[model samples]
Target: MGIEPKNLAGWSDLLEQAVKDTLIPSMKTQEYTWDTTDIVSDPKRLAAFVALSSAGESIQVGFSGEPSDVASVVSQMFGFDDLEDAGDDYSEILDGLAEIINIVAGALHRSLSSDGNNLQLSIPLLIHGEIVIQGKEEWVAHRLTIGDNNIDAIIIRGLIQKQKD
Candidate 1:
């Protein structure tokens, strides 16, 4: 079952903190804007998502960008000097994306689940090529722009609430 936060404001602040900590750890935290950019305009765009669940609610955290752009961000995370140094390994890039989501979700889970409400997480799922994400339209989703990477990160809070059967 998904764990729903009784206080939405507090939950949003935590989510924002997770995003800032995960994406901009090196630099000063910047304000994130509502993301409306079309990432799919680039044919090589890719997306990765990780599922997070608590006693009351479940959420998915995702990142979407062109493969090259994502590599650049991942390279930055790994202390690579430049995008070229990160190379064109799709497997590595996707793996890094999953790691990023994992870290962020883990942090959020820890803080919110401290009240004896365990928050569980699933391995991240990467989607590229022709896969269309179904049932996402009904999710309580938000997209935000982080830094200058030109990628949109998606946060989706699930509407279904039930303890895992």
Candidate 2:
């Protein structure tokens, strides 16, 4: 059976903490706001992104931004000073972001599974280019800035049909 989720406010809190714990302390976090930015439709297209699957994938989590933005956040995550695109290593940044997503997903899974369903987190999926998160009806997005860079934090969740035994 699929695990059920509780009120998303709890999930959102954990997500915010994951970002702060994983990427803060290394960069000057300018501001955080829970805003509905149409990142998929934005011209910048967030350059690169990472996604995590829920138990049965009824929920989805994503973080995305330009290579420069990715490097800025990720460099800080690894305790490296932010650098320009000209000197940043793409692979390292993406991998680090993936790891962060994995951590966030695990936290969400555990909290959502109040019934002790033993939900498992999926491998972080890293991708480049434009993408859209499914199930927007349950979405609650937030945005944060570190230096001049901004990244989108998204959660797309919805009702999952009960599985037949």
Candidate 3:
């Protein structure tokens, strides 16, 4: 199941807090417009697009990077290290990336649903093959910046429905 529209506003607010409390502690926060895009088929892939900038500059923190590095940063915030060391395996690195996305999603879910109701989240699917974001024109991407990254961190939230034949 996906997130409902009525819950998105609260979700976004919670996400902002999660980022500040869990990811970037010294970063400034801002509210941007919320928008949606078409849902992709890949289950490993979470969210539509993510853009995080540090110190007003856009940094390319691709999933191809080291899992240890990612885990280290994330673990520091969450206080638990569930990621396994996979050495130089790219697939393992991708798995770590998916985990990070999941963590972020879970944090959002928790922030939105204060009643402790269960929020269903799809398994983290890898972004493979050809995939195009449908309804790109309808999306309002929000960006937030931290540290020296010139570009702002982006958060895109939208209601996604399955395409009918």
For each of the candidates, the C-alpha root-mean-square deviation to the true structure, in angstroms, is: 5.9, 6.6, 11.0
Q: lDDT of each model, Cα atoms only?
A: 0.62, 0.59, 0.39
Q: Which predicted model would earn the best lDDT?
A: 1
Which of 2 and 3 is the better model by TM-score?
A: 2
What does the lDDT come to for candidate 2?
0.59
- Model 3 regions lying over 4 Å from their true place: 1-11, 25-89, 116-118, 128-131, 136-138, 143-165
lDDT for model 3, on a 0 to 1 scale? 0.39
Query: What TM-score does prediction 2 earn?
Result: 0.68
Steric collisions counted per model: 11, 1, 19
Worst 10 residues of 2 by lDDT: 156-165
Q: Could you estimate the TM-score for every candidate?
A: 0.70, 0.68, 0.44
lDDT of 3 by residue, 1-165 (tens): 233333334445555566555446522333222233332333322222233222232211112122344444434435554544544443544554566556665665565456544455555544422233346423222343332222222333422332221
Model 1 is weakest, by summed lDDT over 10 consecutive residues, at 156-165
Clashes of 3: 19
lDDT (tens digit, per residue) of candidate 2 on 1-165: 443445456556767776666555556663555555664443333333233343455555777777777776777667776444545356777776676677666655555566465665656666555454345356766776666877777665643221211
Cα deviation of 87 in candidate 1 (Å)? 5.8
